[model samples]
Target chain A: MNHSVVSMDATMIQTKGLTRHFTVKKETVEAVRGIDLHVRRGELVALLGPNGAGKSTTLRMLTTLLPPTSGTAEVAGHDVVREQAAVRHRIGYIGQGNGAGHTQRGRDELVIQGRCYGMGRKAARARADELISALGLETVADRTVSTLSGGQRRRLDIAMGLIHAPDLLFLDEPSTGLDPQNRANLQEQILNLHTEYGTTVVLTTHYLDEADSMAERVIVVDHGRVIADDSPTQLKRDHAGDRITLTAGHTDDARRVADRARRSAGAEVTQSGTSVEIRVLGAPQLLPGLLVDLANDGVTVTGAEVARPTMDDVFLNLTGRSLREGGAEPADAGADGGADGGARAAADADGRTTQNQEIAA
Target chain B: MSTTVAARETNTALTGTAGPNRRRPSLLHDTGTVFVRELLPVLRNPFSVVFTMVQPLVFLGLFGPLLSDFPGTGEGSALQWFVPGIVVMSCLFSGAFTGSNLLFELQTGSHERMLVTPLRRSALLIGRALKEIVPMVMQTVIIVAVCMPFGFELHLAGAALAVLILAVMAVGIGALSYSLALASKDQDWLFWTIQQTLLFPFLLLAGILLPLDNGPGWLRTLGDINPLTYVVDACRLLFNGEIAAAGVLQGAGAAAFLAALGLLVGIRSMRHST
Candidate 1:
């Protein structure tokens, strides 16, 4: 039904004020307060947020896994609630939990998923074979999913989602539990798949590099609302900007350079000891002029380095909290609390948070 | 790592549109697939099958001999009279408790995975319920064959009807059990507390340990309202060669009612469940 709509580069996902709130033990935790997001066809968008950011809740509502408390989402040109089957048929979702049966062999699980999507057995088998080889899952395809390592199983979960070759693929933190090497490998495979199939791929992750490297457009969600949405480069340029660092012979020279840099370039400049850090919007071309002006101003520049801002810098510029801190939580902090509770209940329901954090900012 | 190779293959082989199963959605096919997946694990673990059978067999071995000397066991032996109750009890335990596996499924994320699929929620419940039927039938048949040496004379057609009754009972119980499991998704204690509380009362009221007909008036009246009492009665009538009797029909009717009710509850719960 979606394919019948003849427009090229059609809008793949459209949500308007989609919100969900849960009453966990008499406390109403607003997981996703309200979020409006749009993704055109063939775009790889990453929902970048921390643990309680409500990125997972957005994906869940978009994928038709959970109903939004208010507002609406149209995924793959079908209303997530009214035409759920249509949406479900057109999209492949691989949730954060990997969404796989433990005892089933990875290949068989893939085949069943293919069948669920309405693929003929022969076609399902062929696609399963191709995906197994392409994803480097040939080694683990025949093994029981429970026996496979987490990385291997996650890859298999990817293969399962890819079985039907859906128009849109939703991955909720695909690389969360993966090691660095495997994360990179999976990222490569995902990018390759998107490029090959031209599927609208939306993933959520708190991993700075994964989002920075994998997604072309990063939709930064916090506390159930979109904080910033743009290409990684553009977001960096708009929010954090490029930083030019100049090391002077003395702290007096550093301060003089910082003052001149601030006045002449109209940039945000700060000096620490003998180093002056200037955050300027168009750093590359502005640097040469600023250096020449600094020389003209009689400030000796000992060393200079231009560092492009990272996603974390962009996040810091947007929200005060750090993403790395969410990852470095104590091992037992969320161990037994996996069952439904305040923050986690919303987490499980595809919820969001940090709206107050955003509002306060 | 080889992006070019994958991209080249994708250009040549992959299509622009995805949305399989869009043309035809068959309930039987979907249910069949789930049934196979559900049963395969049980088949692999022989220990589970043996463990389930132990309870019913224990009822037959320990209770059957004790009742032989006691009065009120009509024409045939006490083992023959007691076998149907044991069969239904076994079916009740094995079938109604299939939800325990669902607890594991939910924990493992498999249940959530299934829900995201295009498979109908009703089909999901039915498929899981169907998994209990074949095993319950097989277990009941084995119990009947075991009772043959203890003066148990089973009418061929009646024996077949007894299997049907057990299967129907299992479907009803299995569907209801799954509903409860889905409602109490991750809360093992909530499900178990309700399950244990309801189960023994049904067993005791159905008079699985003794015939309630000879019991006090109040107990017999309580047994009359319990659906399992009718099922056990139907199985008894079937075992004693009353396949066409009104009591047999009533028993089957009670089971059918439970099955239909369980299915309704199961489907409704599944629609709202995780």
Candidate 2:
């Protein structure tokens, strides 16, 4: 076990061309494409993708909930396929669905969860008390979980995952429906877990802000493949170019401003509202000339602002599609489809459109 | 290509080093975790406690008195015969209700959370089934207490032994029912309705209220073949101590077989659905 632990520290998680596919009604959908990954000890890694980007599938495969179609995923130095029990013991997972029994009090659930992990009743109870107090669940500790607010319940779910003090924790969209405050609280809890306990965390999220703030490293998955992997700042620096927005006088003048801006900046421009936004690698050098060029050509600019790009921009650069546009047409195309399927498709489309629109923009 | 590299880098940065090689959990541990999580809701909810107690009481009271005036009211008082049957019925009814919790958990995302845990596969079934057993046993006790004055005598000294046997049967059946609920996650109403409809038919057909000899030939044969009939008969014989050693053994065997079958189906169904 110590030897395994040494190797585990060397590579807490390692995957080679890991892939997962599903056949739904005879249509084979590749949810996780071939990819290689190596996770190190005590890191908080965020799996970021749009709805169908396969973030959950990746988590599922790594967690042993779903087997990989090809390649291999090893967790804590054990193969997810063959040594699933080993993998399972070392990791704690809090999936998108919350997975709580509402009728139970928050603290009681944690105690039982600990006991299930082989802790004695006394030990489990002590741990439960510690977590409930640590997570600020004291007020709701004895309340039936069903009576808890959404955010409180999610917090309890996190507490439950940590009851066994697993070395690796998997959180799938942990803050999906949480309020801003709850989301912040959860982010703090995650950071605390990593810092204080040296627990490794692998989480998936659609919230770019959450990903940027919470995750030390971000993995942007698109169409079942790794689209971008880097520190948030590095990713923004690499793919999220400088953004220049020119608010036009009117909608009628939007396209003309966009075309001129596009040519002058040697970048792509898109019209949103009365603004023609241009994204270029070097916005400062290009901006002055573009402003002058527009002024000389009698194009009136109401305002201009240059800002650093975001994860959404990084996504656009990688997949050529904008995340926001995926649902511009239908709000519920994926509703009633299982949670995984809907999420997978959304993430995939986010990746594809980010690339396509990166070129078009 | 650059995008993929960046994404790969990000993936590694976040999840790479934190998973699999660590100390994983065991089956016994995981099952216990799941069971404790499930038990809370059943124990705390007012409705659950009421339903568990009231349903059995209702069956014992309504059926016992109605049959008392009937021409064929046999040896003991109607309440005496009906009490044990309802006690068995409580276990069966509550066992089937286990599915509701699974269905709700799936809908609310709790099921998915549990799936990701290293908790043992058997834990889910065991935890849920056990959670249900306490209430079921309580319901049986209440029914027995209520029927004491009505001429139904349940040997209290032997209550623990009887409850233990009944509990094993209940847990097995509960697991089967829970698995069925998971398989039909979104179609709970349909599944539950089907379960309810199947209940009385199986109950009546199994000879719960009357002896197998009293029913029509086809009915008697159906009772002989019905699993419910076996369970009721087994519980009755054990409670009445009418069966000699062979009869007790046969009843125990039948209960065990059905319980095993139920557990197998339930676990298998859960694995497939999850």
Candidate 3:
């Protein structure tokens, strides 16, 4: 066996220029472009992107499920390609689909998974019992996997991945097909497991709220490229901002207020009829002072509202497209934003008109 | 309190013995684990085993009496000559279709889960192939017993050797089936089309229905090329109380060769499947 020196640093996962490509209908599709990522030990990170954004592809490469087309990745301090077995032994991965066999009992599947990782028969049984109870799967663990509900099956998948208690865990869209209640329950279980075991957890999800509420660090990917990487709060603060909309007595007063907002550095001002919208960072502190100044200027302000940014806003500001709108165009069309400009502009206009109408109503 | 004990036990079970640096289990140990896992479903649902034997039993009842008056079958009850060929046929049909299970697993993502473990790649294929033996043995026993009351002589030692040869052949066919499944992962039609296309030719050329001795010279040449012919001939001889015959050695050699070749291709495909 070939042995390479394992990195002694606290880094749990590191990838440099890692890439993957596929051939579909004789055309080469680059699923994952050059991506450099580092995940420290015990950190919870989420790869946030829409469909076809290469988030799952990047996680697949790190988990040693798919070989990188170029560049290198080291997972759990072992080279993903050269020391694959060592890396596999040290990490657990739950892919997008359910991983347990349909005919086997959930408990039996967990035990066999433990055995695959070289646990003794008695020890594997003990661990299976532990996970069965710990994941609240005792009721369903004895039933066939296919008989369990989606949430139960997903939890069993998690238990299968954790049978060996690997130091690092990778989850690919773990909550894609579940209802909101089940999705929240699964998230709580994942968070609890992460806290108790101190496992380095990396998961990919398109659910903005899931990532926003769960992961400490969120990496935004689109069209096979990493567009932004930061803490969720920092990302919202940097890429998106609060929207402060004011309705005035007349169109002239709205126009005057827009001019004043334009004077504030980096505030994006849009005026329509008697309403003015100001997009700026820190609306909570700036809105009150702007209202008092307007009072002093004798401009009757009829309405005022401030809306904070969501993760969807962070993604929209980075890509000029909403993550809630499902599909992401390929790199050729999306790179220049030429083909998708009209649709994106219409969506933005519709959003603003709807917000203004709601304020009027 | 019990939850805490379970948690502590989990910690020790993970860190104390099953660490990353722990030595990997032997290939045989991993194969046994896979074999047991594969066998559990079959054991739980025994109806499938009986269902698989339905076609062989139908062939025996409808086709055996017609073979009695056929030429070149030699001087013996037709059941003796036909039962061994039926065993071979049953093995062929059952073993060649085993890949569909793997195809289902691949679709469900269970196979991908197994690949991420530290288990040896060869063990996955080998253990699956070995699992075909249990049902093959059971079908053979039932086929032999069903023919006994109809004047079929029971040659214990020769029949045992015949079972061994059939088991080897079944392993070979099962391995090839799994390799085909892996090759045609998303396109299930390819696996079925190939399996169905090749199945009858191998069966007819091997003379499992009627002796190929009276056929045309070109047919004899085709039979010589088809490896199943030797296995069928060898099994027929062994079941007829002629365990010392030279055809038995050639059949064993052919079966072993197929097993080795199937395993080689199967293991390679399993390793590179993703």
Q: Could you say which candidate leads in DockQ? A: 1
Clashes of 1: 8
* Model 3 residue B200 CA deviation in Å: 1.6
Specify the poorest-scoring 10-residue window by lDDT in model 2 chain A. A351-360
TM-score (all chains, Cα) for each model: 0.87, 0.81, 0.89
Clash pairs for candidate 1: A31-A352, A54-A352, A57-A350, A57-A351, A118-B21, A223-A353, A223-A354, A224-A353
Best candidate (score: TM-score): 3
Each model's C-alpha lDDT? Answer: 0.78, 0.71, 0.83
In the range A1-361, model 1's lDDT, one tens digit per residue, is 2466414547998899999776554556677878988899899999998776778878878888778889999888889999887888878888777566777778888777777777778877787787777666777888777899998888778777777777788898888778877776777777876886677899999888888998999999876779999999898888887889999999999988888888755588889999988898878888898789889989999999998888988887787656676632232446544332235434534331222222123
Clashing pairs in 3: none
- In candidate 1 the C-alpha lDDT for residue B185 amounts to 62
What global local distance difference test value does model 3 have? 0.83
Model 1: docking quality category: acceptable
Error of 1 at A155 (Å): 1.8
Leading candidate by lDDT: 3
- Across B173-257, the per-residue lDDT of candidate 3 in tens digits comes to 9999999988877668888999999999999999999899999999999999999999999999999889999999999999998
Candidate 1 lDDT score at position B172: 91
In model 1 chain B, which range of ten residues has the least summed lDDT? B10-19
